[model samples]
Target: MVNYRYLGNSGLKITELTYGNWITHASQVENAQATACVRAALDVGITSFDTADVYANTAAEEVLGEALKGERRESLEIFTKVFWPTGPGGANDMGLSRKHIMESIHGSLRRLQTDYVDLYQAHRYDYDTPLEETMSAFADLVHSGKVHYIGVSEWTADQIRAGAALAKELRIPFVSSQPQYSMLWRVIEDEVVPASREVGVSQIVWSPVAQGILTGKYKPGQAPPAGSRATDEKSGAKFIERFMREDILTRVQHLRPIADELGLTMAQLAIAWVLQNSNVAAAIIGASRPEQVRDNAKASGVEIPAELMTRIDEVLGDVVERDPARTVEAGPRSR
Candidate 1:
């Protein structure tokens, strides 16, 4: 069985491996498949779920609502986020302004068929709106019992500090922050990770496999596999370039031998590597198929040897660019 960790300072405890609607939403995976995958995820001890309002045009929540008909719902920690445009040609369309935030939560609750969300995030830093306004609004949600705890996604470490400080002053409970983190992307290490650690805000990481590039499935000069997320229209044409750059590709390829020696799949190794960080409260994985969930779950307790870490670091150093100690904007997995 997997172990659970206290998420930030909040009362909620969650399994290290969480599932979310980042990819396998109702818009893509069929209803039966989504149900089965979610079931498999829960069976293996995943208690936290991450989703966004814009995922699948609101269909993801609808599907999860249906999936959580009765008994199963009580055992889950449902987390969904706001802060993106959902409609157009109307006055009230998007953003984290007080008006939009208030309305968006109700809409999310209605779609999710739940009274309260375990975690509600800002999705992105809404610099246009006052931080106090946004933080206070989330405080209101907690006050009214519509949300259990508030969180922010992809905001700069400074932004998180401002929001967290505001919540502290207002006496609102803020628990976690979400960002893109994995073997390849370590931008959070610079400031976001440290800021979160200092403020008692645990990190919930997305793209734990570096948008699947770290899985070693894509090779040099090879065509993308059919029906893969890399081929999706939403992904920019440069998706392959940014991740599978010659140097990055070489490093990703090198992991294959390490994975083979450990008798684990590349996907499992990628996930296990990220979970090594104790500050990582949960690593949200997106899977389109039930087997994919099972495959990822197999690495829950697999340990990596210290010698392997040396080789792993050697391989990572060759491909990883930018300073882990430098603070910068998050990657595509932001919210």
Candidate 2:
């Protein structure tokens, strides 16, 4: 069985290693392919799935909901995010406006074929909508049983504080934050992780594989692998140029020996490294096949020794990926 951790301040505990859908959902891949990926994830003890409303133009949820059309729903925690344009019709179509949250939650339920989401999230910060409006709407969802818990994705330190303060006054459950965090992405480590730790919020990390960069599938002086997401037009491969610096590549290259010594894949070692951090409530993984999820699941029980941690820091250096620049100056995480 997968190891579980309580998500932030919420009593709800989920497997520390969870499944997430990005390109895997939506129209980017076939529904049959998506179903296979999810089944593989579940078979390996993944009990949570994180998806966004706008992923694959909202069709991803419909697909997932359909795939979960049996007893499969009983044992799983389904999470879906909002805050993007669902389509081209209304003024209330995007962001965290009260009208959008109110409408979108119902829409998501319809697509998900569920009564309530285990966790409903703000997919990203909404500068246009006031935090009060967003919090009040979320509180209504929690009160009315439309959502079990609440979370925010990709929010900065100030945004989390503002939302948490409002949720506290409203007595609504604000439990977790979803951000791009991984062995290659330490941007959150500098400040965001510390802020979440302080506010008693749990972190459900997305892209735990660093978009497959840290898996050793991509390397310096190597051609992009055939049929890899990095080769796709819509994939987020363009941003990796900054991460592909020679010094960083050298550091990544140094990790191969460690994985080899342990008789594990680089991806497994990369995942094991993240789970060693106590602040991480869960690491959300994306998989296109059963093998990928199975491979990731194996990493759950692999313990990283203190010497390996020291070696990692020394070799990987200070470079880590994030939605923004790794420019934040803050103290290291207190474990």
Query: The CA-based lDDT of model 2 is what?
Result: 0.81
Poorest 10 consecutive residues of model 2 by lDDT?
Answer: 326-335
Across residues 164-252, which tens digit of lDDT does each residue of candidate 2 receive? 99999999888898887778887677677788888888888887767777877777777778877677767556645556566666678
| Residue ranges of candidate 1 with Cα displaced over 4 Å | 89-91, 234-241, 323-335
Q: Please, what are the lDDT tens digits per residue for candidate 1 over residues 218-335?
A: 7767777887766876642344457857677777898888999889999888888878887888888878888898889887877888788678888888466446433343422222
Among all windows of ten consecutive residues in candidate 1, which has the lowest summed lDDT?
326-335
Among all candidates shown, the one with the greatest lDDT: 2
* C-alpha local distance difference test of each model: 0.80, 0.81
